[model samples]
Target chain A: MIQLRNALDVFTLVMLIVTIVLLIYTMSVMLMQRGKGKTPTNPKVVTKVRCVQNDYSAERDFSKGDYVGLEIGKCPKCGDTLKVEAIYAVGGPKEKDQPL
Target chain B: MDAGSSSDTWYLILLLMFAISFILNFTDIPQRIQLWRFASYIRRRLIQMDEIESDVRRRLINYLGKLNINSPKDVVDNFMNNYFLIEPVDIEPIDIIKRLSHLINVRDTNVKTYAERYMPGIQKSERYNAIVALEIASAINLVNKVLKHYFKLGLKNNNWVLLMQLALEMPNIIRIVNSYSKALDAFFSGTPIGDGAGPLLVRYLVGNSEPKRIAEDTVYYETLINGRRVYAIKAEGPGANVGKPGEAVEKLVDMLGGNVSRIVTVDAALKLEIEDTGEVAEGVGAAIGDIGPEKIGIERAATKYGIPLDAVVIKMSLEEAINTMTKEVYDGVLKAFERVKNTINSVGEGGSIIVIGVGNTVGVL
Candidate 1:
């Protein structure tokens, strides 16, 4: 009877320890997430434009109304029509600054 | 231990376990504890969802505030709360595609009409963007409202199973809502999304050619590739809209008297978890993701004409599909462009071909 009691006590002690550990782990996770802040992320976007006459191309910060196939203005170097080629967001979900 | 002592120990252990279980069951302690845990978890997720919903609403209002409207908030609320589509009944399943098509068209027209009523004299592209922004907000609002409804219902009725299921599903729900929130920025800023891969490829093929409007919000350009006359079709863009490519293809086939030899489709496809994003893949059949009408129209038109249908797709995740176009997705678009051209050129016996770039052409011309 003493041996059986000892075994049961040991089992219960181990389970209690597991429950405590799990509680700590979950609470820590919640705390860490709270610390991270819930600010909505804004990804860095760029607009790529190429000269019509020459091969001169450049990428600038994305602006409203900039789209592929739209003529922006004359290229500084070539004096030709500069057309927007692409607009895309850079970086990934795991980047240090972008916590998406 | 002695035999009598061993037997007594076993009896005592069993009695203790039974007693504890009886207490737990009779008092509903275990279920209550489980319910509490699940409720706490779901509550946290509900808080996040609330944040996302409010954020989307703010962004929509900010975009609409710039327009010439009396009450931007009211317009957004109307779309968020009132706009909905009742899916066509499928019990009979006869003329279902046509019915669905009509319903979709009506819904789109209503949305556009609402936008026009509020923001009169705005450019069509801007109006389209406003409509898309409103849609994003509506989706987030719907998700938030549905989740809260279930959350409250479960709590009120003490439904532990319901709460547990909700807690389990909250992670994916939050992820989807966050993605929708991110997509708002893409639409408002006029940036192409991953779904725009198809239209971007079509834009590369149809450079400088005059595009004739073929279907509602859809256009086609007659361009020559390797001396083969190719009709490239895509949604008219720089605004968030997936134009009716199916109707366009059907009409174009009718106009040409079924002279189209091959129909090629390019679009973004959802990839497996193990697959790399922006992977260019080729397959057979029409690569369009419509409820029923658009895809059936393409299939029927191809079947009637006896044309070989080829599909080239850029693989991406659902989140990636809606969010702004990434560099990896753009590279995939370029790769798919090459693959599409190769498909067009592979025909030995030459005939006029229709290459349909099938996706939302937001921010792609």
Candidate 2:
């Protein structure tokens, strides 16, 4: 009778420990999963442009080889037809020249 | 033994209750989160759609109503005060024409009474003067249209030689009429064309050619600035016509033998902010609409041709963009162009870029 009672007590103690361990593991796993989804990736940035002058002339003459040139025209901000030049072309193999 | 046993049973019940409560709370949290997310998402989309629908509705209604109104002061006042919820940075020329037409036709006693009461305070104002001049121009156009029809009919009946002579001189007559219309349009809109300030530069460059030769005009008159061909096309409209910018682009693309790569369309973007100084924004909305059928036709053609479409928006309040264009009016547009130019160059794609400045340049120099 004494041995049976001691075995029963041991069984209850083991079961309680298992339950505690399971609860802790569950909580930790939930927290880890939550942390993974919190951050976001980078978004695409869009650029804008305006034409300030009707007849904008480049301050410096653009050679055929120049990659980009800015035409000094009008100031969009101050309404001043100032020297505002932009990159007009990419001097590379022309689209027609490229063998498709 | 009895008391201790009872206490243990009570403790067991308490733990069981807590366990049940924990389970319920955890289950409820996810459902609550989902509900909140759905609610917020629906709310946001609803608001955006509402805004777009309202704007479209307002523009359509205003355009339809403009031709019928008779008082310039009333039309201007209503437009300035109420037409748009947000003040535009700049007004489009078409919008100015529509408003001017309405102002000239408005015979409302209430509006006239209001104008009379307020005119003394702002009689010398440039805005006021512009409205007055617009009214005068509207009257002139009405008279001219009637006179032209009558004169043409009378000449047709008078003699065959007269009819032939008139037919030969039709272009000149049209030019004179256009000039008169333009001057009136300029005076009211406050963007005089012949004096050389706004759209006239583009129009003179683009509109000089015969209609058949218009397609080839883009290559010579069009400038390749920042990897883009800035082509200007003029077409008749308060509504979009098939012969406008979109058609011109399609014809140009076909001529290039599918070698055309990317297109960047630029146009006036209406701002909703009342106090926003007309500035240009770069991106998609600029080329979306306002060219009528031409815009839709262009989009279809672009899609059919498998061409990539990009846009640059010049920001202006509708009122400012339409009624008046100052030196800084195209400021936002210029900025957008620079950004797009840089982007295209960076990409290093040797594709043809089309930068279209969309608007009615009726009186703009």
Candidate 3:
């Protein structure tokens, strides 16, 4: 009877060890998955402005020191402030300081 | 049975239960994967067709709701852009009539029901006339849609009947010609006349009639207010006489002792659907026929002449300009000119400005 009782005690001890190990492994996995769900915060602030027409030429003959007015609009991509300037004519003279 | 043998039996039972549960869990994986793939395919196709269909539907509903009959031309123009992808094919008159009839029948049925609910007396009054006109417009739009559909199918099957049929329909043919001519006019005539600074001159050296050509050229030269030279060479004439503007520019440059530093070419640009009219966009492209050929020729000539090339493009829609040039459109053009002026300032060489108005100068001074 004592031998039989000792065998039962040994089996119970083995099952307890196995369950504890599994529980620890499951908890670790759940914690790792939870950590991955967080979104990274962005720090940069972006703004957009629409491009409007402005008369920069005093003589209106298209001389130097003239600038195109941009009515700034919000940038569709990255939500940054987009600045649009009218570039040179196609097949026309290139500006010394080209505003891209 | 011995104790050890009984313990071994219990262990085997536990292992069997685990195996059964594992097999059952894995059984659902293939079905889940299939369901996911099917859903993804449907989503992609829906997104692809949604934009085009929605645009078409919006225009159709708006026209139907208006019940106006001023001109079906605008409706056709909008329909071609929103629905038809490219040029219309040749189609038979009978087929076109049949298609139009089918569309009218459907619309009449729907409108009749709608009229009963909303304006029952409209069927007998002037309001009915407006409704009928709208129905006709819808029918015309539907016919265009059908033509587009069949053209695509015909291309795949190499069917000549479809092409010939499309060509036979007189009204459709007229619409196509009118649309092309209007587009050409808008492309050539950047800004509408009488709006800002009035209409500018578009000169063509060659065309269908010499008298017409002379009249056009004379009018262009006579209409100069500020004395800034603006002209365009069209492809409407024979090959020998087609490149007049280029030759004129060349002659002018040579007259100045060939010391030309840079060349500026100005023309009207077609606006995309998303682009607001008068929005200025710059990119390297052809110099004349399109961005490709024009760019190639300009680059080659500039290389030979050792001069720099720049271009200013004015944006407008052929359809919008044809229908009317509102104050807003005129303002847009003035704004574009200002932008052009700024662009020119940045170029230091003080090059000669060649404002080539691209389009048919019909009724334009």
Candidate 4:
């Protein structure tokens, strides 16, 4: 009976350690994720990008469709360089009710 | 090591397990909420199938009725309800439909069932709609089953790690759901998902009327750019579909006697968070999906021929890509069009260049 009790204590200690480690790992992950918006683990970010369009051009009123997003780059009509004139918080933070 | 301390350690173990369970279960609330949304959306679609009139329903009825599927909803519901048990639900159902249709059609070929059963002059569009109804039903079924699975798992809360992992992946899962929703919308509208972008750009660049049907569901036109010929290709648009642009590019390459110096492919790409919609990104290689074989074929052909391949991508949310072409995404079309031209321009006055506007050419003519 004494030996059995000792074995149980050892088992309980091992489980406690495992559980504590798992909890710490989980907490750290959650804290890390809190810093950045929940990006996918695979990320899928294109590092091979030769060119990126960062132009937050003025949010123009389109007669059709709600302004959900902006396609920045070369002007579709003309190949002239297109860039965002000002950031409008269109999609990123503060976009919930931010006016154009 | 004593019995008393062992009992205390057991208590500690129990407390830790309880804490871990609490956190894991708490973290899963967001995913459960998404599942609820998915459930409601799928329920709406299943209900809509009954009332929404005209040919799509009729086609579904006729197609399934012939299959002796008298109560289509029951089959769909059964499939939806029992979907979790359907080992390996990761494969997108719509992708299977095309292959399944081809296989089924081939198997039933000896009897000429399609021609014999349908009324005279039943348009291909009707048949396509029938297939779409089935695909949408399958997609809805998958989501329904998954939503239920998550609901049950949430209730159990036994597998905290599994639940947490799912919680992390919830965004992508929701992203796919949004895309499938758009595809469903496109099906009902009988218009392709933002098809006009690629083809319109192709047309603007080519600046020509005569579009040659070079491959199955693909079209190509040509224009002289700085004393060199540039071949523009896109799926035949203004129809309810994104044509096989990859195959079309291959066909164009072959038709040009394999002397094509450069190939530029343009398509819509899903944007990440903070990446504004309609953003154009220029890069290298193919930028289309759902046509894996075609992408491979093009890549293989390009490699064999030693032709440099460049890609111009119009970035938008998967929601935008699957849904009707929003003004923002459409705006990207012209930008992408311009980018395509620029891509061709940077390639230098080409001996012969192939510019493939790679996307579903659904609306913009």
lDDT for predicted candidate 1 compared with the true structure: 0.87
lDDT per residue as tens, model 4, B222-298? 77877778888876644444566766776677777689878887778878777887898988888776535567657
lDDT of 3 by residue, B1-365 (tens): 45676576567868998987786676765444544454344334334334334444455445434444334345334433232122223365444433543453454456545444443343232233233333434444455456566655645565545544543453344444333333322112222221111122122211111211321121112111133222233322100011223434444445545455455554556666556655555444323433122334445455667766665555655444442243334455566556545544544543443333333222222
Q: Which 10-residue span in candidate 2 chain B carries the lowest summed lDDT?
A: B192-201
**Residue pairs in steric clash, candidate 1?**
none
Candidate 4 residue B68 Cα shift, in angstroms, is 20
lDDT of 1 by residue, B127-158 (tens): 88889888888888888889999999999999
- How do the candidates rank by TM-score, highest first? 1, 4, 2, 3
- lDDT (Cα) of model 4: 0.57
Candidate 4 chain A TM is: 0.38
Among these predictions, the greatest lDDT belongs to 1
Candidate 4 segments exceeding 4 Å error:
A1-100, B1-130, B149-157, B163-179, B347-350
Better of 1 and 2 by DockQ: 1
* Rank order (by lDDT, best first): 1, 4, 2, 3
Among all candidates shown, the one with the greatest TM-score: 1
Q: What value does the TM-score of chain B take for model 2?
A: 0.40
Q: How would you encode candidate 2's per-residue C-alpha lDDT over B190-272 as one tens digit per residue?
A: 33221111122233333333323343112223545445444444332111111246556667667666555666665566655
TM-score of 3: 0.32
| DockQ-based CAPRI category assigned to the predicted complex of candidate 2 | incorrect
Number of clashing residue pairs in every model? 0, 56, 45, 13
Q: lDDT per model, in order?
A: 0.87, 0.42, 0.39, 0.57
